[model samples]
Target chain A: MRFWILLQRDVLVAWRKKSNIYQPLVFQLLIVTMFPLGLGAGAQTLQKIAPAVVWILALISTLITLENIFKDDYEDGSLALYTLSGMSLPVAVIAKAAAHWLTTGLPVIIFAPVIAVLLHLPASAYGILMLSLLIATPIFSLLGTVGSALIMNLKNGGMLLSVLIMPLLAPVLIFGAGAVLETTLGNTPVGHITLLAGCFVLSLTLAPLAAAAAIKVNLE
Target chain B: MNKIVKFYHEMGSPPSFYRITGHWLKPLLILALLLTVYGLIDGLFFAPPDYQQGDSYRIMFVHVPAAWMSMFIYFIIGVSGIIAFVWRMKVAEAVMMASAPIGALFTALTLLTGMLWGKPMWGTYWDWDARMTSELILLFLYIGVMGIYSAYDDDPRKAARLAALVAIIGLINLPIIRYSVEWWTSIHQGASISIMGGNSGIKEWSMLRPLLVMALATKFYYLYSMLHRARSYLLRTEQNKSWVSKQFIEN
Candidate 1:
């Protein structure tokens, strides 16, 4: 009950501070746009590199948004207040991570096809690309939450968060990219998407508790 | 026995570890240097050239040990990381930090030696072979751990905890590296020695003996190097403590 309320509060806060959500989206768009320009607008080249470019940009954007996840709240002492609240801290972490996914990741998924079309990816690849991103982005958000919670109190948190999360994100990227590639190649993408969903579910169940524990440790 | 246990506990203390073990590093370093020289010489010259591979098979002396150590060190790092995460043992975290750079170096060596061997054997210096790619991923994981730790300017303990998490997550790549040939159509050769079955190829006892010695020497070298770096980590982290200051004065 309180978790839903807290999640709503977080979403409202993020909505009010639209820049936090828009910055990463803009960065993702800019990066995805750069490929066509740099590679000379060839539809074939764009189609060939589209999946990798989208996956990599998605990774970078998720990582960039992670920098502010806990840092701003911790600096403002909102985390302490949340800790002092009667609700379970892990529940609170889950709520916050959920809200983060809604604001940052959902938009990325919705916007992926626009970027996909720009890259000249066929309509056939769209469903798998969207599905993989839909499943995989939350995993990135949740994993990024853990990294953010762990390093929330550190100096220069941005760079550290990137290094810590990038390798962990490799498996997600591999499977997600694999799905897109399979779709592009006219192969069955259901298996790869299932693997991506499995990864997302695994991360969703485990990462919030880890992030909550990390936050508690950092606070101490 | 209690007193010896206390001594061992004290040895885990940074001051005592540095005082007692730091001096022994030089001999081990010299031994590692000598073994490396001898292994290279013996492998390059005296070991009879392979009938199938001719002189190029000599790369195995370096390549095999490096590849083995890369996996071996990840296991060590993961185990130590688990200890550090669960027990909050500073020494275990120190061991992990020490092992990482060495592991990365060995992984790099594996890649280099694989490329060198691949050129003559596979006709290309690089291949997207499963084993080679996974080995590359291992190197990236090592870099990620080390880079994250170094990026944390303050609170190394926190950094260690986070790095430990990263290490555990990266363990997925290890099995992939080992079983890559079986799982995928890898250009790399299958295992020559299998515990589950008899040797796939007969290696002469004479060649095996030196290879085994070189492997043991490399293992010892990793141990000695890990202890040295762990001691250094202890010193750096405990520099402001009275025990460290007192030990330095006493020495």
Candidate 2:
């Protein structure tokens, strides 16, 4: 199908730029390292706040890369061609968001355990933290597509994209962090996990349509 | 029904909308001013002090009404946004864009007044209470809407449509955000006043009457401000149209 081909093409294109993959990883690790430096490296304090810290780092690092989702294709005029190619725009949006997650979000999840060690997050929370990120980061990428599409034509859209999407992302941050926090508190994280999955499903269904609309608007 | 449909059709024209809203603006402003003056006087001095908090609770007169306006204006923005996006009506786009700043203003006022009252009663200026957090997010949503509109300065039509999309999305997310925050935790007190009349929010008629008056006043103020802004927006964007030029030349 064209969807898989488009997805593959995008992933391959991003993979060629090796720095794009490592930049967010390095950024996430650097931020993960800062908490200990600033918070005095106390294990108890770090343990208590580790989940939140990890989530916040993921959020910021992801934000750094979101504008790139549409900017490169937009600049090359390929986005317009994609639109006119008879491919479903929302389908193209999904392909782009998937590529985004594969490149950026997946790497963060893979490295989160190593980052978790720096903050002294307990062994018990490791699974829940990863599970929450697994469900939550795709929502981030989905929402990012909408934000990126909305301002793809602008010159300084990076910061504006964050302002536009962060409030919408607040619920995800809350439920994702809450799940990990619940795990640390020795409670059932099932409730938080379910709510997060709900959010993911909702964003998955709606965000692509919204992004497609925004892309059309920008193209006009 | 025919008259209503006719009016709707006529109002779709920017010139007609500007003219009709021009007629309503002065009266709406006067009514809003009169009601606000009376509401403040009656609520501040005449309404009995709360049995527990005494006079400190009076801030609710302003705070609660602004909070209501904030949410109400956002509802209007979302409805107008749907109209703009689906129908591509210029007036709907103008109205949607006009409502954002006013909504943000009211949301900020609500937070400010709430914080001022909180300091006296709860001994802190801010808390992460569910309502407070959700209200804060509402303010950000307003700012985001406005930010997108201004970012597309070169293409006003595109700006309006894109901003409408953002508003529509935010409207859908508002409930989700509120629910997630509530699920996180709630320290704020539950609603005291209900329209269904089953519970006690404000038992005193004197207090309730003025609060209602203030609420009405804020509604009028919102209409006045939104129309004023939309009229200006229409004039600026439609400057090349004959009606816009004629109105300017005649005035």
Candidate 3:
């Protein structure tokens, strides 16, 4: 009820801010493009490194999106207003996380295949790559919310957000990248996907509570 | 029970903790020194080497414990951070601050020993293997928490609270480090069923006994050092207070 409205409000705000939506996409594209240029234009070389490059770029892009999650609203006192609006702060936090995933994370997934092709990722592995990223990126977004909430009011919040969040995202990176690599090698990606999906489910269930608690602490 | 509660209350106060537990520091320090010496001597020289790995396997006695403590300390930081976040408990935050450096130290040791062992056994010093990579990330996570705590210029309470948040967030890596081999088809070998099941196999009782002693000793060393560091942090943070100042002058 209230959560959906809040989620809608978040989506509306994000839609109105085009740069906010496009910056990470552009960054992801730039990172994906640089690898081919740097490593030479050999298809074999690109294929070899595609999984790592794609996952790393995805990670950096996700990290970049995290900075704006709570910082803008907290700075503008919208968070305070939301708190005073008689809505559950936890629910509001979860709604913002969902909106963040839809706007920021979903674009990365949609754009990943294009980058995948550019990196010479096999047409065969595309299904597994997309599936794994679809499952993995949301967990990154959800976990990033906790880090963002923690540093929401800090000076140079964006850099601090990256340092605080990257290590926590390591497992997702490993499993997600491993899944893609497994597909590349003609091995079963099922095990990697299962572990990643498990991680995603666990992070989704737990991260909102942690982020909500962090926001409360920041408010105090 | 009442007396124990009273004792806890007294110890909960930073000044009292320093005054009361301060004397045990030296003895505990000496005991830790002695136990470490004994464990190293026994582990390095006397224990029969593994049938498969030979001398390189002895590195496990050091590497395994250090890895265990790294994960153990991170859990302490996370659990204590929860308490501090939920209840605003000052002592818990103090304990967390104390645990961070020690955790970092153990994490470094784990990596160092694992690399040493790996070079001899795996023929490589480094691999993107699950356990090794996850452990590396754990070290970075510790550094992040400690760095954030020190970077802040304002109220220690606020800084501690923020660091607590970082600790809680960073805890996501702990399980990953612990179960990396199980969760993924890692290059690292899986945990032996015997160790996982708490069964001692063909290993001599003499060897197992020393390892257990060393593990217990390391646990106590962590406690003693954490208490010492916490007391020092409390003294620094509370230095301007009358109670701390009076206690310092009296001592």
Total clashes for model 2: 2
Judged by lDDT, which candidate is best? Answer: 2
lDDT of 2 by residue, A100-208 (tens): 9999999989988988898899999999999999999999999999999998888999888998998889989988998998889888899889999999999999999
Off by over 4 Å in 3: A1-5, B48-58, B169-173, B187-202
Residue-pair clashes per candidate, as listed?
Answer: 0, 2, 0
Better of 2 and 3 by DockQ: 2
Query: Which candidate order results from sorting by TM-score in descending order?
Result: 2, 3, 1
Give me the displacement of residue A55 in model 3, in angstroms: 2.5
User: Scoring each candidate complex against the real one, what DockQ results?
Assistant: 0.30, 0.87, 0.48
Q: Write the per-residue lDDT of candidate 1 for residues B90-195, one digit (tens) a residue.
A: 8888889999999999999999998998888878898766667678878877987787677664778787887876676567545533443333332124443221
The residue pairs that clash in candidate 3, if any, are none
- The single-chain TM-score for chain B of candidate 3 is 0.88
Angstrom error of the Cα, residue B8, model 1: value is 6.3
Query: Which candidate ranks first by DockQ, i.e. highest?
Result: 2
Q: For every model in order, what is the iRMS?
A: 3.7, 0.6, 2.2
Candidate 2 — which residues are off by over 4 angstroms?
B187-199
